[model samples]
Target: MCFVLYAGTSMPIPQKEWRNDVPGLSVEALTERESPIAVHFSKPEVRYIGSTSGCGCDFPHVMFQNGDWPWFDDGEHDPEQEASDRYNREALVNLLQATGEQTVELYGVWDGDFMTPPAVREEIALTVIVDPSFRFREQGLYVVRVA
Candidate 1:
C-alpha cells in the first residue's frame, strides 16, 4: 500500500475515547521505538482502498517540516502530483471519519519505502476510489464528498 504522511494541529484522541467509534473492528495502537509520538493503529477487515505495502505500513508518518509540505500551496504545480496529493488527503479524511477522529491539516501519499518499482509505483498512484461518493466523476480524483 502507498504511504501517506500526516500531521494535525492536535494529537489524535486517545484510543480509549475513539475505540468504540469504529464498529465491528478492533483497534490496536503502536508506539515507535525511536519517537514519543503514538499515531499508529491496526484494524481487521477494514477494506482499505489502494495499494498495500505490507504490515507496519498501515500508519501514516507524522511529519513536522516547519509546515513546508509541497502540497500546501496554491501556485502553479504539476497536475499529476496535485492529483496524487488530493487523493491521499481524501483517503486520510475518510480514514479519520471512519475512525471518528478530527480531520488532520497536513497529509500526502507517497510510494512506500521509495523503492517500489516504477511500474508498481505508477499503478499505486493511479488507484482510483471505487466508492462513488469519494470519486470525482469527471476528474478521476478521490475525495471525501459526504463528510
Candidate 2:
C-alpha cells in the first residue's frame, strides 16, 4: 500500500528507504500534479501504480463502508495482532494487484502519510469495484505508514 499527497492535512512527510511489504501493490501521492481520477471524482490525492514504491508501509486494512470501526483500538495491542494481520494483509494486496495500474484516485489522504505510525486512522473514500469472489474487496484503499 502506497499513499499519494493531497492538500490540507497534517500527514507525515515521506522518507526514503521504506520497504514494500505488499506484493504488486502500487499507490502514490500527487503533489503539484493533477490526478487521472480527477474527471470522475473531485480532486483526488492518490493514484494507482503499475510498478513503483511509495514512501510508506503496505498493510492491507479491511475497512468498512458499513460504518463499523474498531472502538478503542490503537498500537497498544498491536504486537498481538501484527503476525496474523500481516499474513491476511498480504493475501488481500495480492488480490487487488490484478486491477488496472492506475485504478482511481482517492479522497481525503494527506501527503502520503508515510511517516505516520499505523495507530492513527485517516478517513478515506475509495473507488468501489466489485470482485464477486471477494465481496469485501469491493472497497479498495490503503494507508501509507511507517513500518
Candidate 3:
C-alpha cells in the first residue's frame, strides 16, 4: 500500500459529512484495513482513498521528484533521510502557517491494490502541533522530528 500525507484544516468531521458538501470528494474514516500511516494518526479527520484515485494528485509530484525522497549508493554516511525529514517538517510548518490554525490535522491517503505497477507502496508518519509551540514528529519506522 502507498500512503500519502496531507495537512488539513483541524476540523473533526466524519467522512459521510463530505457527501453533500464536497460532491465528488470521497472520504472515509481510517479502519482496520487502513494503511500504516493512517493507523498511526488514528484521528477521525484522517481519510483513505484508492491509489489510482485522483486524490493522490492533491500533493505536488514535483515535491517528491525534487529529491524529497532521495537515496545514496556510496555506502558512506547518507544524509538523504535527514534531508527528507527537514523537508517534511518545513512543509507541515508552512501548511499550518498558511491555514492559520493552531493545530492542523494530518490526513493519510492509502492507495493499496488500486494503484498500477509504476507506483510502489510507501509509508509515512507525521504528527504536528502549533499551539504553545511548533512541532512535527514522524512516528513510523522513519522517525524524524522538529520542535
Model 2's number of clashes is 4
Per-residue lDDT, model 2, residue 124, is 29
lDDT digits (tens) for residues 1-147 of candidate 1? 444322322334233212333322122232233122212212111122221222212332322234322223356577664455454445444555554433222222343322221111111121233222222211111222322
**Which candidate has the highest TM-score of all?**
3
> Taking the candidates one at a time, how many backbone clashes does each contain?
3, 4, 1
After superposing candidate 2 on the true structure, give the runs of residues whose Cα lies further than 4 Å from its correct spot.
1-70, 74-80, 104-147
**Residue 75, model 1, lDDT:** 62
Worst 10 residues of 1 by lDDT: 117-126
Q: Candidate 3 clashing pairs?
A: 51-111
The lDDT for every candidate, in the order shown, is: 0.29, 0.32, 0.35
Candidate 2: tens digits of C-alpha lDDT, residues 110-137? 2333333232334322222122112221
- After TM-score superposition, what is the CA distance of residue 80 in candidate 1 from its true location, in Å? 1.0
Q: Which stretches of candidate 3 lie over 4 Å from their true place?
A: 10-77, 112-147
